[model samples]
Target: MKILFVEDEATIAETTIPAFQKQGFPVDHVETVRDAEAALSVYDYDLILLDRVLPDGDGLDLLAALRRAKDATPVILMSSIRHSVAERISGLDRGADDYITKPFDRDELISRARSILRRPAAMSRRVIEIANVVMDIEARSLIVGGTAIRVARRELSLLEQLLGARGRIVPREAIERNCYGFDDEVSVNAIDVSLHRLRKALVDAGARIAIVTVRGIGYMVEETV
Candidate 1:
């Protein structure tokens, strides 16, 4: 999954970005509320990690704006000053999916993020099954026609996006935004190359599925009839 991390503290960001990366989640970090808003306008993120104290303004204002716009993207509010029970309640009431105090354990934060993603509002599950392919998301394992196959991280993310859509066309722009971090140096044909390799792997593993390319548009996953 992709995350938008809004925090101004360089030390905390330096420590936390790698933690999420280790779990295969690409993070786009913005230090200020304005940068976070700019990023949100450009890309769709699976989760948002919002810091309550920001250089520009209160993070709660951003959260409130998001809720007002009817954006249901899961958000976890983080703060050191707002760790009290009443403040936490206020943050939650302002439309945060969860509240995490600063000086938190990285593991605990990851666990809470996973829990939020599994909720019905997030529309992600622990496992996904489509045609002869079965993906255990938490395990990061792919089983096609009872045979296991190894997929690169990017391809796995692309597959998850496609499968999650349940056969709907996933736009190329969306794929690029979701599969790669803002700072990642992606080549012009990177998505095509990865998709080609994924298609080859799936076919070799006897998956009864097709990753169809719509000319100049995007791609979709469908069972081979």
Candidate 2:
């Protein structure tokens, strides 16, 4: 996940940036509304952690501008000034998805952020069946047609990543980062080997879908059409 954090508090930014990074999320931190605007122009973020109060402007203004420009990225307002119900209403009405009062627990914040990103609607069904392949996320099982296809732990993780991506080609780096945490020793050819083995297993099991190689790009799981 990629996140943009707009906060004027140096201590908070310092603490949160590494925390999110440790969780395999890339974070860009900005202290002022001007920096936030500038950063938004250059990068696309899956979520924005915005402080409701900024040095140069109100955070609500930035949220409004983003909406005006058709940037629908989820924004969660982090504020110390929201003491009343009206304040919360204003923030949400201006485009914030959720709000966190000041002095909040970092873990809670992280959970909320993940929840927003992984909303049920954003992910595919509990069981995604493409072609003759069936992935049961709730059961953590894979079946091809009527037979079970055994996959390694790493291979299962790779498949989950691709399936969660909903047909979009996921890059090699993303797969590596998602499967193995940041400190894992992963070789450049590791993903290729995993994909090769996975393909063989699926093919041998008569799976209908194939993991298509996109040639120097990445891999995509799609129907055999």
Q: In angstroms, how far off is 225's CA in candidate 2? A: 16
Q: By summed lDDT, which 10 consecutive residues of candidate 2 come out lowest?
A: 176-185
lDDT (Cα, 0-100) at 175 in candidate 2: 74
- TM-scores for every predicted model: 0.89, 0.60
lDDT of 2 by residue, 1-225 (tens): 467888889888878877876555656778899988887776666789999899999999999999898878899999997769999998899888999999888888988887887667445445777777888754457998888877876787688778767689988767765666333478878988998999999989888778887888888988775
Which residue pairs in candidate 2 collide? none
As for candidate 1, its clashing pairs are none
For candidate 2, report its TM-score.
0.60
Local lDDT at 123 for model 1: 51
